[model samples]
Target: MTEFLPPWPLLTAFVLASLALAITPGPAVVYIVTRTLAQGRQAGLASIGAVALGNLGNAIGASLGLAVLFSVSALAFSVVKYAGAAYLIWLGIRALRGGAAAADGGTVEAAPRSLRQVVRDGFVVALLNPKTAIFFAAFLPQFMNPAGSALTQSLALGVAFVLIAATTDACYVMAAAAVMPALRRAGRARALGRYLTGAAFIGLGVFTAASGSRAAK
Candidate 1:
């Protein structure tokens, strides 16, 4: 309803905006970077897959007017926000303690988790973010084509945003992985990675805790 027109005409601008947003640093980006740095590209991709799906769920929910619940219900928002913040901090602490090592200068190859569990962890990380719903609510409307079905337009834009994010995030992950061999060859990076990733997660949690309702991206 906000100057929305035919999608074809608006598509280019939407893509540009989405790219800009995707490139801008956020919790999702930080998470991907941390995962890649802590493990490898594959782990980063796994986390991204879950995050994307979780975001897709939020986008669909936003298209369905779920933000209204957050808008009108402070308790709901606070509960979700706090929960997500706590979970991130917990994960950070766990990473700090474990550091994903086997105490013999080797990675944790023995830790075998099903893809389903990985997906679930990622989904929960995303689902706990109330701000993402708020973000979709506020951000998508600007590019929406009111001439078309508003819900459909929102959904389409949301998917596009997710795709853009994944592409950009993949680039970053790959770059981080590309450097792994160098870091490994140098040795003494295990503790560094543990502190860096743990701090990032904790920082993200703090940022989430401080976020306000209706704050734009």
Candidate 2:
């Protein structure tokens, strides 16, 4: 196992790069933060877990040559990208509708999502984005020792990246949750928060659809 690892210099670079990548706010961070703001810490943490698993799946898929398929086939990439965008848009629309209904019914808050549903949503959000798999495929190879077992090295690097990402994601969740109380102090504010959350989701979806593959890098 140790023999498959990269040299110290390459490993240090990989860790630094992974930290930078994980800290940069992307679709995954936005989704997790939105869940945290709307639901609570628990939901945010659940989303983190689910997204981590999804990212791991993407990493494994990359190791298995799925990224190559996306690279060669525009249609395949488009299919997955559109599916993810559509799902995000759907979530946004649902959030907006829920907010409107709450206002009409004289309620301060929208109904809470179940943890299972949140997990499923987070998983799908992470998994359907082809960029993650492409990123893993593109990024993981840089530090791998050519003489080492490619499969083992890729898997190890992928897991490290995922763990780093999960940690950063948790930090975002904590920060969002910290401010959540202030945002929800008033009924009107709570209602407005829902609208903002919905708009954020919609905007994220649009951005995802419009973004080129270069954005992942």
Candidate 3:
């Protein structure tokens, strides 16, 4: 049997790549930013916690070769991708509606959401995201050592990804904190921000839905 462990050089490369990818602006980043700006730093942190947990699931799945299954099984991938897209669209619609309501003199609370709820929501949002699943499935393979343990390599790569993502998301929280006061002081501005965020979610959903079909590797 061939070993599936990654070499030190490959591990180094994977770590660097994972860190870079995590820092890049993406949907998760947007979600964290919007949540932080709308609620507060605490809410953003909560969402991050949720996202980390979700990513951990993906890591485990990938380690177990479920990501490989996703890559190979069109039906499974479609199921997950469509579900994620639909969820994003639903979230967008809700946000847009909420924005409209707020514009009409609805009271807006500045209070942050409970940590548990934020973590749960974040975990689902990140876990169900097909992009993340596919990414790990494809990306982790490049550095895989034929002589090492596949599970260990996958877990290691996943840990690096989660750590990098957490650090970057924390920065997003801080950035949102800088603008929280402004958002709270101007109801109309906040409403507009909410609408824009909703629009972004909608666009992401459409993009996900339209993403090309991929064969399992």
Candidate 4:
């Protein structure tokens, strides 16, 4: 075990950075927000929980030398990145194909989904996101102590990051929930919700596909 934890200053910096990153809406954040708008608070929260676990796996992968593999081979990075992009695009297509009227014949539209589906889909979405994998691969090493145990330091930082992310994601769900009622009143909002969510997925796909072939060293 790496006996020493990161010093207070380093820890503080990591917390600040994590908070900043969490608050910024990336593909994962977009996925979470879109789900919140399309589903209810419960679904949104569940998705957040699922994604956190997926991210934890990614963090562990980075710690276990996936980062080194990505850094050394541009082809590996490109393959994973494009594969992820294809998955996102396919999700968008699926969303476009499906439709569900509101249960009460109201303007508020919800995707017809069971909680299990929500959790599973959210996990897969997060797990397949190459940007996230690369992000962990790049970000965690900056905080690791070269002379200390790399495994211990990676585990610590990864857990902290996941916790921070889950908290921030919950905040987003609550905030979205607060306005869901009002939005639900507008029939246009219902259609817009579906379209926006679908579009967000497509946008994420395009964004991912546009990433350069060069892997960050």
Candidate 5:
């Protein structure tokens, strides 16, 4: 499958596609920002670390063959998609019900989720995302070499994609953290984070629901 890797044209496309996807705001980004503003920089960074690690798992799964497995099974896809959606709804509802305010008077900490919990949450959120699976399956193949080792090439491209994604996501975390003081003064920053986190989940859920339609398109 060395022919699987694309030439210059495809390599260029892969770079551009990766860049665009990295910059797009999504559930992972939302979670990191919310955690940083609510629990403090340490908490936020921890979640970021967790998410980056999870991306690796997603990439590996794609390279190792989960992509094909999940892509062909409508029942499996539905199960993962609906579960993701319901989780998002739950996160959003949890945020809305919290009335606590942070000591800084700008944000509030509803309840401090443990580092383990946050990491586990981040893992599931990224792991269950069919988008990642499909993306690697399709996108990596574009840059693969047919005469080369298909699995090896896929693994390399997948790792590259994950590294790029992690770097961009970290930038988002820092950028969001930069605004912490200002947001903190509003006294509802924590609530806002919770709400946003919830929204991310819900939005992803909707995206998951629409994936089948999109695949057809």
Candidate 6:
């Protein structure tokens, strides 16, 4: 296992970089925290697991040359990018509509989703983001051992990054879950939370779409 990894110094750098990246909140973190705020710890955990799996899939895809396709083919990247952005926007609209309905009916929150649905949503959210695969392809190579097998090293490093990210993501879920009760205690705040969540989703979608346009240039 050690033989398959980069040199000690490089490995340390990779670990540090991974930790920094993981600790910083991204789209995945936002989605997980939103789930925690809306549902509970269980749903947040499920989202984390599903998103981790999806990220692992992206890593594997990067290892298998999918990232190469995205790098060389703007069309391929755009298709996936738009699809993901559309999905996120749709989720936001649905959340907004749900919140509106709840407000009209004097409810505090939107309809709760099942664990399975939450998992599916999280998985799709991660998997649809082409940027993750592209990022892995670009980021993992910098730490790879030139003497070792590229595929093996990429897989190992990708998995390591995912694990680190999942650990950090779990921390975010815990933190969000802790504050959920306070949000729920206030009737207006609880109702307002749904709109905020919806807006966050929309903002992420717009950011994603805009990033793709910039990348194309």
| lDDT by residue for model 5 (1-217), tens | 3344556676677778888888887656776776676666667777777776767776788788887877888787778767766665665555555533343364544534678867776676666676567667877777776777787778777777777777787787788778888987887665576666556555655665665612200
TM-score of every prediction relative to native: 0.87, 0.94, 0.84, 0.86, 0.79, 0.92
Ranking by TM-score: 2, 6, 1, 4, 3, 5
Per-residue accuracy of model 1 over 99-119 as CA lDDT, tens digit each: 655455656432124556556
Question: Candidate 2 on 35-105: residue-level lDDT in tens?
Answer: 89888999999999999998999999999899889888999999998898898888888888889888688
Output the lDDT of residue 87, model 6.
84
Model 4 ranges with Cα > 4 A deviation: 1-4, 100-112, 213-217
What candidate 5 gets wrong by more than 4 Å, as runs, is 1-13, 100-111, 210-217
Q: Which one wins on lDDT?
A: 2
Which structure among the candidates has the greatest TM-score?
2
Q: Candidate order by lDDT, highest to lowest?
A: 2, 6, 1, 4, 3, 5
The positional error of residue 133 in candidate 1, measured at the CA in angstroms, is: 0.9
lDDT of 5 at 191: 59
lDDT of each: 0.78, 0.87, 0.75, 0.76, 0.68, 0.85
Point out the higher-scoring one by lDDT: 2 or 3: 2
Superposition error at 87 for model 2 (Å): 0.4
Give model 5 RMSD, 1 decimal: 4.4
Residue-level lDDT tens digits of model 3 in 53-98: 8887887787787777787888898888888788778777877877
Over 50-161, each residue of candidate 6 has an lDDT whose tens digit, in order, gives 9998899989999999999988999999999989899888888878888998868855345346889889888988888889998998899999888888999899999999
Poorest 10 consecutive residues by lDDT, candidate 3 = 106-115
**Residue pairs of candidate 6 with colliding backbone atoms:** none
Expressed as tens digits, the lDDT of each residue in 102-172 for candidate 4 is 43355432354788988887887677655566777778778766777778787789889999999988898
